[model samples]
Target chain A: MALIEVEKEGKDMAGTQEKQPVRVRGFPFYPHFLLREVVVMCIVIGSILMLSSLFPAGLLKPADPFDTPSPIFPEWYYLYVFGFLKFWTFDVGPIPAKIIGVTLPMVVWYGLLIMVPFIDRNPSTELKDRKFAVGMGIVVLLGILYFTYYSIVNH
Target chain B: MNLPDMIYKWFDDRFKISELLPPIVKHPAPEKVTSNPLYCLGGTAFLCFLILAGSGIFLAFYYKPTPEEAYKSVEHIMTAVPMGSLIRSIHHWTANLMIAAVSLHMIRVYFMGAYKNPRELNWVVGVLLFLVATTFGFSGYLLPWDQLAFWATKIGTGIAGSIPVMGPYISLILLGGTDITADTMTRFYAIHVLILPAAIIVLLGVHFMMVRIQGISGRL
Candidate 1:
């Protein structure tokens, strides 16, 4: 596709027209993006309101530091990390199990995610062309699902 | 011509909203990117964040930060104050939904390879935004001062405390001491309402700006 060249008047006294190349891009933001956003906003707000009314959040008894609860777990999002820590109990020689378990998975998971664009230098954006990237993504997704399930069941 | 026009002209002369906004509103997005509904998850997450912010502000009116009165205040909000329960519930559920939406958005970005080249920095910013949003959840979870909240925080911080040499110091910083005290509750409350929200808002601004500048990535 040819780049679209747009002409604009320059700020100099000559008032010369400068040609700038504009990348032919997506749909216009006004009606396309804005209208869809409005609809999504309404749906999200409406559903949340409906859900809240149907099932109000319950307050448990006041926190007691003296009495520790059994099977304490963080929110669902952190359950994968929790489960990873639980499963990787073996120590690596001098390193403590907790440190290795916590740091390793975090480093690997976050490292891979944050480093994706840098690591995958392939030019093609196609899925088939990026088999390794797609496979890795699927692996991470399944790992999260499995670990979350394990954390819940074991807890 | 009229009062409204005069006011608009005045503002436009000062702020240049008329000159600036049209280009942004009329920005072009790839047809392939715009066709897919999956690409909208980030906006959905942002919408949920807006709801959470509104409901959270409403909840804050009745919430107390002290250990002695925190639970009582929450109970009052839930039982005594009109629409308090609904507001609190919406805040809670929307937080979870935001996390879900962000996760799905990240996944879509990943599978679509939208993080390539000029968009790399935005991806990093996105990851930071995700972390800040979850931290918002963790901090806000403790505000109720309920049994589950206490235990969950204890374990969550305990996990943090397992970070080798920096563990103890990190725990100290998070708890504001050795244990979960009134100080800890106050700290969490401040972080939730002040620090995380500020960070998230700034990061969101950058993320959106980057997306606008780079344009949406083409479909696979």
Candidate 2:
């Protein structure tokens, strides 16, 4: 009788252990994650297709090596760098202004960006808590915008 | 067994796709990121890349890499080929949008502090991807072989030439000479279509894998 009772207890323990839930980390990725992605992708692609049909890209005159166009600038994204070249014309002794202009912006931009993960020791992800970092981002954005505008107007 | 089951059993015995697909198909994504619009930027940028690839392949069918024929070929595509202008426009617009979307995605990641701890390496890969995308833009700009393309490239190469010590070498390597000639066009063409695409794809794969393993970062 005692042996049978012990066997029953063992079976009960095994059943309970088997019933313990597996710790699920997050939501199922298929229907939920994939559905959202599909929707966003559709919107993006549909808009691009619509825009392409509505307004086709223009082709300019063939390239001439001898003749340089007035107000020569790169695409809109590069306007900031072009404007930076024009703006930072002050010369330092020995070093050319062009090098300073180019190197300074490149260094500042990539330096801060690459250093962020290392320097930003704050574990918090809150915007209000990361005031300095957020402030710096806003300032850099405004600076780029201003330079881009300057390039457009001056050109 | 039924025909469908028989077919499945045959394939499952040979490939084991049924065993392989479940984990991938049912992979978990962080609950916080599922509903957020900000998290969608990366996906959006990737979509733009897909558009670029499809449209670029179409453009390549008619594009000529030589200086003499490059401009004329582009013009012909725009004016002559069926739906060519539309494809070209899509490619152009998609490139611009990809750059914009990638920039915004990086900014969002930064502000969200998604580049913390275990995710830092992916952040570096993201930065390299950004640089590669910008290079793609620069190289592709010259391929149109127009007045704007020519001058813009000259100025761009000039900027590289101004970079203190290695400036001259970098410019020389880019141009394949002192000036923008036939060689420069070929180099840009190769880099735009071949080198950049390969590098970006590999980096993107790494970036995606890291994201998958790490899951999404916690909400701010």
B1-220 per-residue lDDT for model 2 (tens digits)? 9999999999999999887876676665655677688888999999998889989989999999999999999999999999889899999989989999999999999999899888988898898898889899999999999999999999998987887787889899899999999999999999999999999899999999999888778574
Model 1 chain A lowest lDDT segment of ten: A5-14
Which portions of model 1 miss their true places by more than 4 Å? Answer: A1-25
Q: Per-residue lDDT for B41-76 in model 1, tens only? A: 998998888888888889888888999999999999
Interface RMSD values for all candidates = 3.5, 3.7
Error of 1 at A25 (Å): 5.3
Which residue runs of candidate 2 sit more than 4 Å off their true CA positions? A1-26, B1-7
What is every candidate's C-alpha DockQ against the true complex, given to 2 decimals?
0.52, 0.42
CAPRI class of candidate 2:
acceptable
